[model samples]
Target: MKKVGSFVGDWWRLVSPYFRSEEWPYAIPLLIGAIALTLGSVGLEVLFNDWSRRFYDALEKKDEAAFWREIMTFSWLAALFIAAAVTRYIVSPYLRLRWRRWLTGRYLAHWLDSRGYYRIELERTIDNADQRIAEDLRQLGEYTMQLLLGFISAVATLISFLFILWQLSGPLSLKFIGIDVEIPGYMAIAALLYAIVGTFLANVVGRRLISLNFMKQRYEANFRFGLVRVRENSEGIALYGGEQREMDMLNLRFADVFRNGWRVLFTEAQLTLYQAGYAQMAIIFPYLVTAPRFFAGAITLGVMMQTASAFGQVYTALSFFVNNYTAVAELRAVMDRLQGLQEASDKKPATAIAVEPQPGGRDIAVEAMTLALPHGQTLLADTTLVLSRGTSTLISGTSGSGKSTLFRALAGIWPFGSGRVHVPAGARVLFLPQKPYIPIGTLRDAVKYPDEHSAASDGEIVAALETARLGHLAGRLDEDTHWTNILSGGEQQRLAIARALVFKPDWLFLDEATASLDEVNEAAVYDALKRQLPGTTLVSIGHRPSLRQWHDRRLELQRTPGEAGRLVEGAAPA
Candidate 1:
């Protein structure tokens, strides 16, 4: 019971938000209408059950006129049922679609906001968030509607038919131990017991399916991610001739998928075997239990048939859980994944460096900042630094000395740290990594990325590209393509520099951003920054000796064995 309550709470957490959202006006009405249709369908089934009794009795009595009359009656009931089903077909899917759209929007907003996506990746807290947002939300929306409506309909059917079955069943009188025993509503009792037993067995046989489905989703996502990685890194793979290695890795991922899939298939088959046998037996079990009354002429033909139909309805209603155990298991897995992602995204680190903005300030300051790796190893201890406006500073360090991590700390995305970083309020800051991110869009958009809505005119973009030595791409500003795949490494770097030029941020931090370019092009790009954005402070992380000449001050991260590195102001290496 406690577990059931917790599961309901988790489901409500995922479901109730949509109906309570801004779309509630539309969402609520559709939901109510769907429930109404489901109940109406159940009502139709009850009418059909009564009609079956009348029609069969008419045939038994050879009353042709009454038979035709019941046929006409059945025609109307069938029409209503068909109309209800058609309406449901339309209303249900549209409702699911609207709900999914709203949910997708909300998840996307949360995942993208405050760099939650990056932090999730950095901490390795959740896997395949894209799958959660895309596929799992889809399944949640569809299955919620399906199972909710189905359960409601089942309850309605049970209530409407249980009384009819009880009255039709009459009483079973038996002599036990020289005492007369009369059991009332014997057929209803039989159905209840039978369904209880079936449900228990179904659960016992399929209990492993929930975890299996969970692992199946993960394995499928991992395999798909592997394929996407191969496509994204196709060039590198080809350069190193690692096709066979990639194939082997992909085969390993798929082996998990195959092994888990076989387990799911075998388990489902066992459940299906029990359900199929249960249903087939249910077809004749009603007659078997009620046969003595009919044979003894205690009940009419119509009463016997009515008893059977009512028994079927009551039993089906009681067996809802047995029939839907597989779907329930799948939904549980989806809920677990989505809840995990929400929890992970909402979590905050115990100790994080504070990044505050200083209004009307002219410099950026990192005060006694302690940066660490995700594993709790201190990278930079008690590091204090300041970057004055209109100056260029080059930060150099040995490999793995936390230069890039410090850059992340300044950017306010690093969570494994403590202290404070104060940036000038309303200051525009840009950090260009070694491999620039070229969104799959127009050339102009790629250059104006991280600020897609910037009002930089095409002329300015062309000028920026020309300044960054990517003048060759200036003419193709409007061409939309996979800019990352089409652009060479050096060209992508130049495009990033073009972005820096266009945005003209108050501060620019480049972590080996120009490493792909030759010395001449690198120098040209740096000189252009000096000439075009003299007021912008330039902070760079690179080991090239040639880079020192571009900056006014050089800071190196000096480290000792078993101690965190510290930034030391030093002369540029000659």
Candidate 2:
């Protein structure tokens, strides 16, 4: 019971967003329309159940005219039913799409907001975010819609049909050896009782199926993520002769999936045995209960048939949980995943960058500060620093000595420890990482990313490329291709520099932005920056000591074993 309550709670949390969002106007109406149509369908079913009795009576009495009239009445009811069913069909898909759209947008916003994506990546968060967003969201919508409509229909049918069956069935007063055994509406009571017992037993036997299904989704996602990882890094793996290892690893994940899948299959088979048996028995149980009354001549054949139909409706209503057990289980899994992601995203507070505007205007400051990782491991400590305007500062240190980490702290992304990062308000800055991000678009859009494609002029873009010693790339700016895959590492780096030159940021920070380029090419890009934006401040992380000569100041993180890296002061006016 507690487990069931937990599942409902989680499901509500997952689903409430759509009804409360911008899509609610349309979503609510479509949902209400679908529900109304569902109720109408149920009403038609009850009417048809009532018709069954009259038709059967006409048959028993050999009344041809009466039978034909009943047939035509049934045809009219069938048309109404078709109309209701069609309305439900039309409204349901619209609601599903709108709900899915709202949910997808909400999840995307939460996942990407305020460097939450980066934090999740660093923390090795719940595996297969891609699957959660793509596959699970799709299933969540489809299954929820089906279950909701199915349940509503079941309830409506049960309530509407039960009264008619009661009148048709009359009463049951059985005497076993002269003792009274009074069962009122015996057929309906028996169907309800039978469904309750069956559903209860099914749940007891299939409780483990929930866990099995959850693990199956996880295993499938893990196996798929492994295969995708291999595909994405196939080139690197082949170069290092690691295909065998990757294949072995991928096979291991697949084996986990196979193992978990077996558990689900076995559990579901056990459930299927009970459910199929219960459903088959349902067809006859009504007739058995009403047979006595029929034999006694208390009711006609039509009443017997009507009793059977009503019994089926009651059984369906009571067994709603049983029939949809698998979907419920799957919904539980999706809820768990989405909730985890939501909690993780919400936990990361927005870290405000402490960029205090200075007297000299736009000078960056890190005053008596420290930066630690989310795990409480300090990356940089006791750092009192200032980067005045127009000064080219180079950050040099051994790899993993907190050079790039400090840059991240400065960028207001590494939200770990206490400190203020001060920069002048309204000052624009850009951080170019080791490997530049080449978006899937025209070279112009890739270069002018974070800004609209329409923001930068073609001549200005070409001029920036020419300045960065990537003049050859200028002619291809109009062409669209996967630039990251096609361009050499050095060329990509040069392209990033060209982007900086075009945007002319107030402060440009590059972490190993020139590592892939030859010394001459690196010098050419650096020379381009000096010539294009001599007044722009540059803070760069690089291991090549030869490049330090271009900077006016330096900051190095001194590393020690078992101790956090500390930023020490250095000379200026290089």
Candidate 3:
């Protein structure tokens, strides 16, 4: 009961936003139209129930004229019912689509903001976020439409049919211990009790399904993700001949899926047996109970049939939750997953990188900066460093000396740290890591990205490509393809340098950006950069001996005895 209460509360919290969002103009009208159509459909059912009694009575009387009149009545009722049903069918999906659109946009924005995607990965706060956003959101939208319409229909039918059953059932007289007693609406009362009992048993049989469904979703997504990873890295695996190892890992993941599938099948099979029996019995239970009165001549044949029809409608309406238990469980799992993603995205970092703007400043300064890994191991303590604007500085350190980590801190992305990083106000800064991100798009779009394709003129783009010795790609700017897979390592790196030239930021930080190129080609690229972006502040992390001559100053991360590394000044060898 407690778990059910929490699920209801969380579902409402997750769902109420769309109705209140900026898209309410469409959402509100579609919702109102769908609901109105549902109520009208219920009214048509009530009319049909009346028509059934009249048609049967006409048959009993052997009257052809009255029979034809009732047939006409039914034809009109069926036509109206079809109209109501079809209109609702069209409008309900529109409502669902619009709601999903609003919700998908919001979730994507929140997940991408504040580096939430990156932070969630570093901390492992949530698993399968991508799947939750893409797949589970779609499920939520679909289930929400079906469940909402079903609930409304159930409630309305229960109300409309309860009165019909009561009027048709009349009264039943019973003897108990030599005393006589009469019960009104006996068939209606019987259906109420039957539905209640069935619901209780179904809940008892199916209550464990919610948590199982949650884990099953996670495990399935993990298994699928593993296969996708293999597909993306198939080249590397083939080169290393690690097919057997990959197969073993994949099999291990699939075992979880197989094991859980059996459990789900077992539970569903049990529930299905009970549900099938319950539904079949409902078809005849109404007749069995009310036939005694009919045989005794207390009611006519038409009354008996009307009574059975009304009883069926009432019972089915009351059994709504019992019939939809599995769907409810699945919806609960999706809602909980989405709730976890939202909570993880909203979490505040324990440590933050403080970026301060210095007015009229010419240098980037780090004061009392402390660097720590995500696991809380300190890398650098109380490190202070400065890089003047329009000057070339190279950062050299031993392996694993927090060189790339420092660059992340300066970029205001590494959050497991405390420090003040002051940059010149209004200065544009860009960071280029060794493996730069190459989005799947046209060559022109990839070069300008993080920028629109039209951000740079054609002449400027051509000039930057020529300077980086990537003139071969200039003509292919408008051609759409996955340039990442098509370009070689050297070409990709050169394309990244060309991006820097096109963007022309005031400060550029390179973390082994040119490591893939030959020494001569690397030198030529640097010389071209110097000629093109003379006013840009260049800070680089490199290990090659040939890189020292381009930079005027150098800094190194030196180890201290029994303590973290410290940043200090250093000089290049003559």
Candidate 4:
């Protein structure tokens, strides 16, 4: 009972949001419509139960005309029952689609808003986001529709049928050890009690399934994520001959899935043994209980048949929870995941980046800045620096010396820092990481991205591409497709250069953005920057010795293995 209470409370927490959301007007009406259809369906069920009595009685009495009449009556009643059922499910898919759209949009907004998604990745362990959005939302939408409608119908069936069953049962004579006690309508009470017991036991045995299924989903997603990562990095792993290691790691992840799946199958099989057998026995239990009285002619055959049908309805209604244990538990787990994700995505801003826009000066300054890792390990200390507007600089450092981490700090993404950076108003700062993001869309949107699709005309976009020496891609501006897989690393970097030119930002930070390109391509891209964006400030972090001549100022990070990171000086180009 306590466990059941907990689940009910949690389910309400998860379910109440949708009904109260901005879409509630449409949702509420459809919900009420579905519930009404369910109630009508149950009512038809009751009428059909009553019809079974007369029809069976007519058969037993060998009354041909009456039998035909009863059959015709049952046919119409069945038709009405089916129509009600249809209404209940007719709008079900539409409702599911709408609800999913609302929920997915909500998640997306929350995840992307205010750097919440980035913080969640840094600070929390909520993985399988794709699965959460796609699989969980799909299941939640469909299950809520099916389960809520079923609950309504079950409640109505219980109320309507329980009354008919009590009245029809009249009196049930209890017998044990040759002793007999007669009680009014006691058979209805017996069936109710039996159903309640079965429901309780089923819950006790199946309650752990919620956590199990939750873990199962996680493991499956992890396995799939492993495969996706492999597919994405196939070239690198193959180059390093790491296929065997990758296979072993993937197997370990999937092993969790296999073991948990076996456990579920084992337990589910046992549950089916009892639940299926219990339900099957119910079909005959009613007839058997009333058989003696039926034989003794305590009532007509019609009453007997009606008593059996009513008993069936009462039991089925009472056993609803037992039947839906899996779905209910799985839904609860999904709710927990979504709630956790919402919390993770909405995490509070860590100590704010002490960076500001300079009022009249065209310069970037860092004063008494301290950079730390997420766990409070100081990576850089007492760093004060200034880069005037229109000055080109290069940041150089050894392997794993917190150079990239410093870039993150300067960009205001690495929040484990205390510093002030001021850029003049209207100065757009663009950071191009080694792995530039290529959004799936027309080439124009990818190039002029984070900009509206209509912001740049085709001529301007093509001209910008030509300036970046990516004239080959200029013709594909209007084609909507995934360019990430199609473009080579060198071409992608060239396109990144196009983005810098098209946006015409005041400051551009290139974090090894030209690493994959040949010297000719790299020098060509740099020349394009000089020609097209002469007044823009350029700061780059790279390891290539050949990149030294492109900048006028240099900064570096040096770290001994297992020691803290520190700033060091490097050569500055004239």
- lDDT agreement with native, every candidate: 0.91, 0.81, 0.87, 0.83
Off by over 4 Å in 3: 176-179, 559-563
lDDT per residue (tens digit) for residues 180-217 in model 2: 88767766677678878988898888888767777887
Candidate 3 weakest ten by summed lDDT: 559-568
TM-score (C-alpha, index-matched) for candidate 3: 0.96
Determine the C-alpha RMSD for candidate 1 after optimal superposition of all C-alphas.
Answer: 1.4
Local accuracy of candidate 3 as per-residue lDDT tens digits, 88-126: 889998888888788889998889898888889989999
Off by over 4 Å in 1: 176-179, 572-574
Model 4 over residues 479-553: C-alpha lDDT tens digits? 898788788887888888888888887899999999989888888888889888888889999988778888887
Task: Pick the winner on lDDT between candidates 3 and 4.
Answer: 3
For all predicted structures, in order, the TM-scores are: 0.98, 0.95, 0.96, 0.93
Runs off by more than 4 Å, candidate 2: 349-360, 571-574
Location of the lowest summed lDDT over 10 successive residues in candidate 1? 170-179
Q: What is the lDDT of residue 426 in candidate 1?
A: 95
Report the Cα lDDT for residue 148, model 4: 86
Model 3 steric clash pairs: none
Poorest 10 consecutive residues of model 2 by lDDT?
349-358
Each candidate's root-mean-square deviation in Å? 1.4, 2.1, 1.8, 2.4
